[model samples]
Target chain A: MDTHAAYKSRWLPWVLLLPSFVILLVFLYYPTIETFVLSLFQVAFLGLSKSFVGLENYKILFTDPDYRQIFKNTVVFAFFVVIFSMAVGLALSVLANQRVTGWRIYRLLLIWPYALSPAVAGVIFLFMFNPQSGIVNYLLEISLGVAPDWLTNPTLAMALLVFVAVWKNVGYNVVFYIAGLQNLPGEVLEAALIDGATPWQRFWRVTFPLLSPMTFFLLIINTIYAFFEAFPFVDLLTKGGPSNATNILIFNIYRDGFEYYKTGMAAAQSVILFIAVVFLTILQFRLGEGRVHYGG
Target chain B: MKRLVTVIGLSALLGFAFAAEKVQITFWHAFGGGRTAFIQRAVEDFNYTHPGIEVKVEYKGSYRDTLNAAILAAKQGNAPHIVQIFEVGSQLAIDSGIFVPIQDFVPAGLEFQLDDYIKPVANYYRIGGKFNSIPWNSSNPILYYNKDIFKKAGLDPNNPPKTYNEVVQACEKIIASKAAPKCITWPLHSWFVEQWIAEQGALLANNENGRAARATDVYINSEAMKRIMKWWKGLYDKGYYAYTGKPEDWDGANQLFVSKQAAMEITSTSDVTFMQNASFENGFELGTGFLPTADGVERNGTVVGGASLWLTKGHPQKEQEAALTFLLWFTNTENMVRWHKGTGYFPVLNTSVKVLEWQHWFERNPAYRAAFDQLLQSKANRATQGALIGPFPEVRTIIENMIQEIFQGKDLAKALAEADAKADQALKRYNASVKK
Candidate 1:
C-alpha cells in the first residue's frame, strides 16, 4: 500500500495557492523590495527627484542618537508589554479555569478589550489619564492625595503606555490560555494531586510544562504585536513626545516619512525595523521551541 | 417588468449625459471637525451656483497628512486640482514643482482686486513678487483670558497682559489668589516661537528669512530665540504655565482654558467663535488681547498661521481654469465675510473688512477684531513675512522636542545650541535633496 497521497493534477495545487500568493506578492514582497531599493536612494518630491546614495541613509540612522534612543525605547516597551500581558493573562486564566458560577460571563467580560482597535483604546485611555481633568487623576488625587502627571512626566507616560498596552492585550492572551487550560490532561493533574503536590507546584511542574507550546506561541505573537501594533496608540495618545520618551520605531517612521517628507530616511528606518523584528522572531524560535513540551 | 427596465435605462442614460457635461475637479483640504462641515457647505453652495463645474471636496486628515497625500497622488498622476496646504508647508509646496503658480492664471482675470487681500497674508504667500498660492483662512495668535478669573485675582478684567513680564505678573497673581490651578497655557508649538521671533523684528533664518533665496541655515540660537525661550522656561519653572505635555496640542490647551484649569491661553485667532461659545457654556466672560511681546520690545507683529489653496499641475486647462475661478470666488469679499462670520479666520480682502466695519460686526463681536488689528498693524518686513525653509515641518518638530527637553530640565543654552545644529543640518539635507 502506497502511503503517498497526491493530487490528480499539478495545476490544482498551483491554482489553490495563487490567490494568497498574489496577495502576498502585491502587499508584502513587492513593498518590502521597493522599500529596500528606496532605502539606498535619496528621495524628494515623492520620488520624482532621486539620487543613488548607497548606504548613506543607513549610516545616518545608525549614527543618530535619537534613533538609538528610539530603538531602546521600543525594546523596553515590547519587553514590558509582553511580560506583563502574558503573566496577567496566565494568572487570570488559571483562576478562571475553575468551575465557578457565571464563568462564561467572566470570560466574556475579560475578552472584550481585545475587540477594540488600538486607536480606539488609545483615545479612551488618553481621556481617562489626562493629568488635569481626567477621571483617573481625579480618583487618584482623592484617594492617594497626590496626582502624578501621567502624560508630562517621561517615566509616567511610558508606564501609562505599557499599562494600557497590557490591558488591551491581556484579553487576547487569556483567550489562548483558556483554550490551553481546557486541553490539559486531567490524569496528569489528578496524579499530581494524589502525589500531594500543592496548587502552585501542580501549576509549575505539570500544567506549566504541558502548556509550554501555547506559551511559546503567544510569546512570538505578543512580541510582534507589541513592536508593530503600538503605532496607533503612540500616535493617538503621546505622539511619541514628552522629550522623545515614548517615541518608538513605527511612529518615528510615520513622522519622518509622511510629516517630515524624509522618505528615504524613513525607508532606511523601516528596513532596520524589519531586520530587527525578523531577527528577534528567528532568535526566539531557535532558542524557545526546543524547550516547548508539545506532546504532554 | 419591461417598462420598468426601459424607465431605469432612460434615467441612467440621462444621468451619464448630465455628468459628462459637468467639469468635475477634486479639492483636497486639511480642515477637520466643524471646519470640514463648513467647507462642505461652501462647496455645495458653489456647486449649486456653478452648474458647469462640480467641485468634489475631501477632508484628508491633518495638514501634514493632506500635503503628503497630495504629493503621493501627484506622483501617481492623479493629483487633485486644488490642495489646501498649511503655512509651514508653503516652502515645501513651492519646492515640489508639482503646482502651477496661481499667478500664472492671474491675467485670466479675477473680478475682485488681488491687492484687496490683507498685506501680511499676501506677503507670506507672494514668493518673489508672484502669488504662489491663494491665501485662505489666515490667522494669528491672540491672548485669550477668562475675565472671571481675572476679577477673582483682583486684576482688571478689561486690561489683559501686554508683555511677557506682564503675563508672568498676571499669572503670579492668578495663582497666588487661587483663581486657577495654573496661570496660563499654550500648545507647546513652534509657531508661537516663530511669532515671537518675528515680534522682535528678527529673522528666523539667513537670506532674509529664506525669502531672498533658498534657506541654507536657521537661527535657532539667536538672541531673540533665547529671550523667548528664557521667558517661556521661566514660566514653566515657576509652575505658572501648564501644558498637556504633548507638542502642538492646540485642542488640549483650549481644553485646559475652557475647563478653568488655566486662566489664560494663547491660541489661533481662528478659534474666536469656538471660544465665544465655550465662554458662554462655561459661564465666563472672555477677554481677547494682543499676543504679548517681550518687555521693552517694539512689537513687530505676528506672521499668518493658517492654510492657503494651491493649484496642482497636470490638470487639463479647463479644470485648472475652473479651479482658479473657484479659488478666487472662495476668497472673494462676500465669501471672506461669510467665512469670517462662520470661523474666526481673517477676512483677507480689504473690501470684506470694510463690509464688516460698515456692518459694525466688530462692535457686536470685539474678540474677532483683536486678531485682525494685530495682522493689520504688522510691519511689512522680512521677519513678519515669515520664514521659508524647505524642511520647516521637520524643523518645527525639532524645536518642539527641544522645548520639551527644556521643560524636562535640560540646560537652555545647550538645548538651543543643539537644536540650532540639528535645524541647520536639516536645512542642508533638504537643500541637497530638492532641486531649485
Candidate 2:
C-alpha cells in the first residue's frame, strides 16, 4: 500500500499514520477514558467536588427498576425502528425500480426524506401528528370520528416515535436498496422466467440471494442509526414520558448529564449505551456473516 | 529632539490612562417571544441613561438552557457578567460557586438596602443572612378563569373558587352545564404541585427546605402531598380535568383555556398579561384570583416563580461594579414599576409598589391587584420561603411524572411513595456531588 520511495527509517509509516491515531486518541479515546473515570466519581459543574464513589453510580443504575425499564425501552425501540424502516425501504425500492412513466420522480421523492435532520424530522412529525391542531388528528376526527392522542398514550406514543424514525430513515435505506436492485445480473432472472418460474419465485430464488450483501450492510447501519440517531425524535416529542413511557437510554443519559446535571450517572449511562451499541453491531455482523452472499 | 519626543510619548500614554471609559458587560437572560421587546427596551433605556457603563443583553433561551450555558461558560472561564437564573435553579447556582453575592457586589457609595426588596420575593433568594442574587421579575401562581364560561355555567364569575373542594364544585357545575368540554385543564407541571404543598405550609424537603442545611429527605409522601395528590387524581377521575401531557406544555393549556375547551386554569402570575390579551382577542371575560388552597386550613402563600439577577465572579472588579450599578439602575423604583406594568411580574420593590399605588396604576389595571395582593399578603414562613434543595428542578420532574402516572390510574399512594423515594435518592446524589 505504500506508494512512496523506500525510506531508510522504519518509523516513516508510523509518522505518516500518527496524525489520524492522535486525532482518534484525543476525540475518541480521551472521552471514553474520561467517561470511565467520571462514572466512578460524583462530580458536577466544572469538575468541582469530585468524589470517588467506587462504581456506586453503576450499581444504583442497575439496581433501579426505572433504569432497567429504560434499557428494555431502548432495545424495543431500536428493533422496531430498524426492522420497519428496512422492510418499508425494500418494498418501496421494488416498486420504484419498475420501468414506468414518472418512475424517476417517484424515486427522487422516495429518497428526499433522508435529507432531513432528526430534529427537523421530529418537528415535522410533531406538527403533522400533534394532538391539538395536527392535520392527522383533524382528518382522523373527521373521517374515523376518533382522534387518539398520538404523543401521550403510552403505546401509541412509542409506536409513533418508531414510525417517525422509520419514516425518516427509509429514504436512506431505499437509495441503497435501489442500488442493490440495479446491480443484480439480468441473466439469472431471465433464466428463471424461461424455466416456468413465477415472478415471486424468481425474486426469492434469484434476486434476494444476490441482494444479501446490501441487506447485511444496511442491517448494521440501520441498527446503529436506530440506537443513536433515533433519540432526537423522543427528545423533541415526549421528553421520555407521559410517565417515562419513552425513556430511551440515550435520552435518559442526556437527562442525567445535561438536564439533571448528574454527571457521574450520565457518564455511566453513556458507557452502558456504548456497550449496548457495540454488542448489537457485533451480533448483526456475526449473524449475517454466512447469510450475506457474495457476487456469483 | 530626543528629549522632546520622549516627553510627548509619555504625555500621550498618561492622557490615555486618565481618560474615562465605559466598561461594557454582557447580561444573559432567558426571556423570549413578546417578552423580548420589554427587556430589549429596558436594555436600551439603561444604555442611554448610564453612559459610564454599557449593558448588553442576550436572550439565552429557557432558564435551563441559560443555566447550562452559564455552567459551561464558567468552566471555560468566560461566563457572562450577569445571568438571569429562575428561582428553582438558585440553589444549584449558589453551589456552583460561579457567583459573587449581591451583597458583596453592591457599589460601596450606593445606599441600596437588600431590605427594600419585597418580603416573599426576596426571601427565596436570601440564604443564611445574605442575598445571593437580586430578585428580579418574581411571580406567584394565581387562578385564571373565563368569566363568560362561568356565567354560561350559571356560576357567579365574581365568586371564584377559593379552595380545592370549591374548585371541584365549580368544575362539576361547568361540566354539567356543558359550557366547556372540560371544566379545567392545565399543563402537567410540578410547579403547581409545589405551590399546592406550600399553600398547606408544608415543606417540600426536610432540613428546613435545605435552608438550615443540605436536605436529605423530601416530604412528597406527607399528609399534605397525599391530600393534594388525591384531589388531583379525583379531578382526573371525575372528568373534571384534562392534561396537556408534558409538564412544560403550558402554552398548550393556554390554548385550551382561550379556545374555550377549559373554563379555568392555574398558571404563573407572570402570564396574567398574556392571558388577559388572549381573553380579549378570543372574546372572553378574564377573571383572576388567588390560586385555590385546600378548604378548612389556613391558606399559606405560594413560592416566588421567576428568575433573579446574579453577578458572576471571575471578572475584573470594575466590570462587577459596573454590572451591579446597572443591576441597581435597572431595578430602581421607576424601572421596577415599568417592568411590573409591562409584564405581570411583581414590582419586587416596596417603593415601586408604593409608587404604582400612588399613581393609580393598579387602579387603572385592576387585574394586577390580584397577584399583588396574593404575594404581598403572604406570611414569611419556611414553606413560603421556597425550598433551597440543589436538585429542585429534577425533583420537580419526578413529582410531575408521578402525577402523570396517577392520572393514568396508577395507585396514588404507591406512586407518591415511590416518587418520594426516587426524589430523595436524586437529592442525596446531588448532595454527594456537591459536598466538599
Candidate 3:
C-alpha cells in the first residue's frame, strides 16, 4: 500500500513482461497499423513510393462484383464449416462417450485427419475424385453407370470444398468435444437415468446443454480456420476454380497481394475481412451467451 | 610444467586464429527432384574446380517462392548472391533495384557475344539494350502424346494433332474406341493460353505482347481468345479433355497419360525426360509435336517458360566478382551442354547447341531437338515476344480462372469479358502505383 512497495511490485512485473510486450507491439500492432496506412495509398513493387488514394481502394472493392462474390463465398464457407464441424464433432463425441468396443481406436481415427497438412489433403482428394482414374468415379460408373466431373462442376466444386474443410477440421473439434464431454459430472447423468429419462431426453436436456461452452469455442476457432487456413486447399486443389466457386476471401487476398501485387486492394480486402470476422465473433458471443451453459 | 603449458597454448591459439578456408556463396534456386540433383552436381563441379569459392545451392521452393524470399531478404540485407527467377518475375526483379545487372559486371564492348545467345532468350532479360539477368534454363510448351493410345484408337501414331479440329477428332476417336477416357489433359497455366494465342498470331496484351513497352491494358478477350475458349469448351463438353487442377499438376497428367487414361498432353518441354523415363514401364512410346493451330493459321511461335539467374545487389567487390565468375562458368559452352543433356531445358547459348551437335548428341537422340526447332522457327513478332505486364502473374490467374469458369459451363464470352475488365482494373492499379 506504501508508494515504494507498490512501485517495486509494479516495476518488477513491467520489467519481467517488457520483452513480450515489445515483441507484440513491433510484430503485430506495428504491421497492423502499417497495413491500414498502406491501404489508403497506392504501393508498388521495386520502390517505396506510395501515394494517398483516400478511400479509392475501398470504393473499387465495393464497386467490384468479384470482390463482393469473394466476400460472400468467404462468409458462406465460414458458416458451413463452423456449423457442420460442430455438429459432426458433437455427434462423434457423444458416440465415443458410450462404453463401446474399439472406441479408443475410433477416437484416434477421428483425430488422424487433422494431422495431415491441408495441401496434402487437397492432393489426396484430387486423386480420389479424379473423373477418370479416381475411385469415386470408378464406383459411380460401376454402381450408377454415370460419373460427373466433380472439380469441373461449379456447384459440386463448392460442395467438395466444404466437404474437405469439414473433413479436415472435424477431427480437431471432436478432440475438444471429447475433453468437454468427459469433464461433465457422471452423477448428473445418472440422476437423469434414475428419473427414467430416455437416451434422447437425457442428451437433449442434459448432455447437449452442458456441451454448449465447448460448442461455442469450437464455433469461433473453426470459423477462423475456415476463413484463413482453408486458402491453401483452394490454392492447391480448386484455385478458386470451376468459375470462382471456391474463391474465398483469403484466397482473393493472396491472389491480389502476392500474385497481382495489388497491395492496396489486398489491404482493403483484408481490413474488410478483419472487420467481418470481428463482427461475426461478437455476434456469436452475444447469441452464445444465452445458449451456453457453464456448469459450476 | 611451464614448457608443456607453452606447447599446448601455442596449438590452441593457432587453431582459434585460423578461419575457414572457403568463401561460401548462397545460390537460391527453384529446381527440384532430378533437376535439383543436376544443379547440385553442377555446383559440386564448380566447387571442385574452384577450391576458394564454395557454392551452397539451396532450393527455396518454387520460382515464385525464390523471388519473394530474395526480395524480402534484400530488404533485410541477407539476400543470396544469385537467385533463380522465373521469366514472369523478370521485370519485377529488374525494377526492384536490388539486382546488379549482369551487363554491369561483364566488361562493356568486350563482347560477351550477346548475339551468340538465342534471340528470344536474350531479349527476355534485356532492358534498354542491357542484360538484366542471364538466361540459365529455357523451355517452351510442346505437344506430348501417348503413341500407344493413338495407335489403339486407329489413329496414326506418327502423325499427331496438327490443327484444333484434328485434335478434337483424335480425342473423339480415342474416347469412342475406349482407349482413353479423355483424349487430352491440359495443364491450367495462363502462360499456355498466352502461347496458344501467340501461336495463332494473336496478341494477348498490347505493345507487341509487352515486348516493346510495358503493358498497361489487357486484350485477352479478343476474337482469337474466344475461338480458343470455344474450342476448349467443346472439348470439355465432349469429355475429350480433362483438367489437371493446378499448373504444377503436370505429374498427375503425366501419370494419367502413362496409365492410358489420357491419350495426349501438352506441357513444357522440360517434362520430356520425365515422360520418356515413365514410358519404359507402360511400354507406350512417347510422341512429341508442335502445339496445334486454329483453322488455316500457321503456328507463329511458343513463348519460353523457365527461370533465369539474377545477381542481387549489395555484395562486396570481391563477392560480385565471384558471382560474375560463377555465372560465366555456369553458362559456358561445356557446362551449358552438360546442363542441357542432363535436364531437358535447351541451352541458352549457341555454342552449347553447336557443341551438342558436334558431339552428335542430337543425332543420337532426335526427340530432344523439337524444343530447339520450335524456338528457332519462331519469328521475332510482337505476339511471340511474350508479355511484360506489371501484374502478369495475377493476370494469368484471372485468365486461368476465367477458362475454368467457361469449362464449368459459364458463358465463355461473358466470363472472358469479366476477366478482361477485372484485369484492366488490376493493370490500372499496378500502373498507377508504378508510373513516374
Candidate 4:
C-alpha cells in the first residue's frame, strides 16, 4: 500500500474547487480589490471619471473631525454590539438549556427576532421604542411616570442599537450553545455530579470548557455581523443622527458614497472598515486560542 | 432541441403580441403607496391615448436612492428615458451632463408655454437661464396647526402666527395652557432651515444661493441663521418644543401633531392631503398658514419641495419626444388639477390655478389654498430661488447634524461655524472633481 492516499486525478480536485473559487473571486475579491484601487483615485461623474489622487481620501479621513468621530463611533458600536450580545447570548442559552417544561417554546420565541433582516429588525425596534407612541415608552410612563427619550438622547440611542443587535443575534448564539451542550459527555458530567460538585461548579469545570470551541467560533461570526451587517439597522432607525451619535462605519460609508456621491471617500472608508474588522478577528483568535479547550 | 425551439417560438410570438414597434420607454421615480397609484393612472391614460408608444414606470426606493441609480445607469449606458429628481438635485442633474435639457424639446408637440410654470417651481430647475427639466410635482412648506389646540391656548384658530416672534409667543401660550407636552413639533430637516433663511430675505449660501455662480462658501453662520438657531434652541430649552432627533422623521412629526403631543408643525404642502386624513381620524381640525418669517423682516417665500421630470439623453429621439410629450400633458391644466387635488402638491401651472379658482376649489379646500397663496405671495429673489449645488444633499446633512448638536446643547455659534466650514469643504471637493 502507498504511504499516502491520493485523488484518482489531481485535476479533479482543482476542477471541483473551480466553482467556489470563481464565485469568491467574482463576488468578494473583485469588489474588495476595486475598493482599494478606487480609494487611491478621485472618482466622479457617476463612475465615468477617474483621476489618481493618491492618499488624498485617506488624508481627509485622518484629518476631518466628522470622519474621526464616525470612525470612533464604529469602533464603539462594534465593541459593544459583539461583547454584550455574546455574553447575553451565553446567559440565554444556559437558561434555555435547562430541563424545564415549555423550554422548547421559550427557545423558539427567543429565536424569532433572528428571522428578520437588519432593516426589519431596525423597524421593529423603532416602533417598539418610539418616544411618544412606542409601547415601550407607553409602559414605562404607566409604571414609572417617566420615559427616557429613546432616540433623541445620544447615549440612549447607542444603547438601544446595542440592545437590538443583541436581541437579533442572541438566538443564533443560543442554537450553537444548545448543540454544544448536547454533545457534552454524559459519563464525565455524571462523574462530576457524583463527586458532589454543585450545579454551577459542574457548568464551570466541565460544561463551559467543553463549549469553548463553539464560543470561539461565535465570537468571530458575531463580530462580522456587528461590523458590516448593521448598516441597514442604522440607516432605517437612526440614519446616523442626533449629532451623528449612531453614525457607525458602514452607514457612514453609505451616506458618504450613495447619498452624498463622494465615491473616493466612500471607497477609502470601506478599506478602513475592512482593515479594522480583519485586525479585530485576528486579535480575537490570538488572544482567545489559549482558552478554547479541545476535550478528548 | 425541440423544447428550445418551442421556447424561442413562444417568446417571439409573445413579443409580437405587445410592444413590438411601440418604442418602449421606462420612467423611474421614488414614489410609493398612493403616489405610485397616481403615476400608474397617468401611465395607463398615456398608453391608452397614444398606441404608438408604451411606457413602464419603476419605483427605485427613495429620492436619493433613485438619483444614485439613475446616475449609475447613465454611466452604464442603460439610463432610463425619464427620471424624477427632487428639486434639490437640480444642480447635480445639470452637472451630470446626462440629460437633454427638456427646454431643448421646447414646442414639444403642443402649445406649451414655459412662462406658465409657477415662478418658484421654475426657478429651482432653470439652469443658465433655461429650464433644464420640466417642473412636474411641486410643493412648499407651510405651517400646520391644531385648531382646537390653538383655540384652547387662546390663539385664534382662524388666525395663526405670522412672524417668528409671534410663533414663539403662541408656543409659550400653548405650553402654558398644558394642552400638549410641547408647544410645537419640529423635524430636524435642513429644508426648513433653508426655507426660513429665505423667508428672512437671506441667502443660505454665497454666490446667490449657488444660482449666479458656483458656490464657494456657505453663509450658514449669518445673523439670520444664528438668530433662527438661537430661537429654535430656546424652544427646546424652555420645554416648548418636541424633537424626535431623527433627521428625516417627517412622519414622526405628523404623528406628534395628530396625537396632540404638539400644537403646531411645519412640513411640505404635499402633506396637506395626508393631514386631512389624520384630522378626520384623530378628531382635530387642522389649520394652515404661511411659514412665519423673522420678526421684522418680510417673508420673501419658500423654494419648491417636490420633484421634476427630466428627459434623459442617450434615449432614442422618438422615446425622448414621447417622454417630453407625456410630461407636457402631465402638467397641463387638467392633469395638474388632478395631481394637485390628489397629492396636495402645488398645481405647477398658473392655468391650473385659474381653473381651481374658478371651480371654487380653494374655498372648498382651504388648507390647499393656503399653500397656493404662499407660493403666489413669494418674491422673486435669489434667496427664494433656492441653493443649487452638486453637493447639496451632503451640505444639508451637515446642517442637519449641526442643528441636532445645537439642540443637544452645543454652542449655537460654534455649531454654525463648524457646519459652514464642512459645507464649504464639500462644495470645494465637488467643484474640484467636476471642474473639467
Residue lDDT tens for model 4, A115-185: 87878788878888878778998999999999888888899889888788888888898888888888888
How should the candidates be ordered by DockQ, best one leading? 1, 4, 2, 3
Residues A119-194 of candidate 2: C-alpha lDDT, one tens digit per residue = 8988778777766566898899999998777766788889988999999999999999999999999988888999
Give per-residue CA lDDT, model 4, range B1-436, as digits (tens): 9999999999999989876878788999999998998989988998899898888999998998899889989988899988999988888888888888878776634645578887877777777798888888888889999999888888889999888788889988888888677787768888889898888889887788888898888888899898788888888788787766577888888888888889999888989999999998999999999987788777788877788888888877777777777778777889998999998988888898899989999999899988989998888888888888788899899988898899788887788888988888889999888875
CA displacement after TM-score superposition, residue A109 of candidate 4 (Å):
1.2
RMSD of each: 1.6, 3.6, 2.7, 2.7
Q: How accurate locally is residue B251 in candidate 3, as Cα lDDT from 0 to 100?
A: 67
Candidate 2 deviant stretches above 4 angstroms: A1-3, A6-22, B1-20
TM-score of every model?
0.97, 0.93, 0.94, 0.96
What TM-score does candidate 4 reach? 0.96
Instruction: Supply the DockQ value of model 3.
Output: 0.54
- The model with the greatest TM-score is 1
Clashes of each: 0, 0, 0, 0
Off by over 4 Å in 3: A1-8, B1-24, B108-110, B246-248
Ranking by TM-score: 1, 4, 3, 2
Interface quality of candidate 2 as DockQ: 0.56
The CA lDDT at B246 in model 4 is 74
lDDT leader:
1
